[model samples]
Target: MTKVTDVVLNLIKIKGQKKEEAANTNERPPAKKQSPGELRLHKDIAELNLPKNTKVTFPNGKDDLMNIEVTLRPDEGYYVGGIFVFSFHVPHAYPHEPSKVRFITHPNIDLEGNVCLNILREDWKPVLNINTIIYGLNLLFIQPNHEDPLNHDAAVVLRDDPQKFQRDVQAAMLGGYVGQVYFPRCK
Candidate 1:
């Protein structure tokens, strides 16, 4: 009986070791989570040079630094007196990947808030930071770039008839319908 008990214990130990090895082989140790971007972001935030009419807020609370809201109130140009809201989502990749940005839905902004601007798309470079983004958003209102516009109709109107484009912008900002599309008042 003693010999049988010893053999049983040895078999149990072998089975346990095999199970441990299987789990270890199947499960990889998680990669070390290093966030160099978070530190850089803190520095960028400290040195933020936003225009006078632009303001940034974190709706998810100050503790949640990953997401931010930028409100641009361009004092000049066609979009003057209108308030534009944009959201910035900083990804884990940081400076390596550009922060994702979206604006409140408007003629310029699709339903997904994907506002088309050079910096957010083709013009984006790792060197650009939050400050540059603010400037870009400001430029969107100060001067609507028709050549590479996201809103094709708006761009055509702006290119062909500047006055009519201004009227459409005004109407849209005043919560009216422009060509059957209803825009909420953002002025």
Candidate 2:
């Protein structure tokens, strides 16, 4: 409503005319620039419903909420005793635009295994929150969705046989080779 702010906003739009980012583009924004999703993430983490075996920590510190690492230990599955780490890269649009995920270690799971899940892919919806995503990830270890896997080879082995998949998982977790790829010990 003020003349000065209106002028500044016009200038920002002219410089960077992203329609989606228009609302947050203000004058004297803040000392620390956080995304709209940042506040949402803070609330989500505060009221987090993670299992005892799973924990999410900000490696960069609590100040940086955009990035977080989730450590999961499934007690009753192929990945039991295995420590799997995944980083959730929360975008400014976040719930609107999905956060990226990268697995730290595994055999049935791949390093670039973000696109494997339906939730991260075609089935993503704004209604889904961090907790939902975390649960989906936990489900992966209990039952790796081989049908829609990012690693085609791993998926194939997991689908074709259960015993071989278990052997491969054990080998990979112990810092051995599954196929040609070697995995570092995550135990």
Candidate 3:
């Protein structure tokens, strides 16, 4: 009986050793590799020289390099003196793929926060940097394009009646009603 017990214990020990070895040998952990886009975003941030009244913050905190917030105060245009905030999400595929940007203002923002900027979407290329995007956003406010618009209504007004569109933009910036929605005073 004593010999049998010793044999049983040895068998158990051997089985446990086999299981441990199998786990160590068979498992391959997932690799962590930063994409080209992420590399570009990092480079862009490091090289950034922001303009006055233009601030950048990482809402997800510094530890998180993927998300960021950019606030703009245009010196000229209908959006002049207005504070507009934008959010940028850098996916793992970034630099190679354009960063996903969103406007996080009041609910008064168009249904899609669609910043109908050519540089941001159609004209985007690896050569473009954050500085370019910032400048483009400022341009959008200074000269809201009627021909190519994210907000159709705003575009229509801008195309059909430039004066009324300007008035509506001013009204919205001042925290008034352009239609049924009330915008917060950003100026």
Q: Which number leads on TM-score?
A: 2
Runs of candidate 3 with Cα error greater than 4 angstroms are 1-35, 104-109
Work out the TM-score per prediction.
Answer: 0.77, 0.79, 0.74
Q: Name the candidate that leads on lDDT.
A: 1
Q: Write the per-residue lDDT of candidate 1 for residues 1-187, one digit (tens) a residue.
A: 9999999999999999998898799897645554777666777788999899999999999766778899988899888999888889988777777788886433456656787867777777778788998897787788777887667778889899999989988998889789877888999
Q: Give candidate 2's TM-score.
A: 0.79
**lDDT of every predicted structure (CA atoms):** 0.81, 0.79, 0.74
lDDT of 2 by residue, 60-109 (tens): 99888888999998987899999988888988897887788887443335
Give the per-residue lDDT digits (tens) of candidate 3, residues 78-178: 67788998887877766656677776222223545656667767788878878777777767777777777667777787788888877887898888778
Residue 44, candidate 2: Cα error in Å is 1.2
Candidate 3 is scored at a TM of 0.74
Question: Which candidate model has the greater lDDT, 1 or 2?
Answer: 1
| Count of residue pairs whose backbone atoms collide, per candidate | 0, 0, 3
Off by over 4 Å in 2: 1-33, 104-108, 111-115
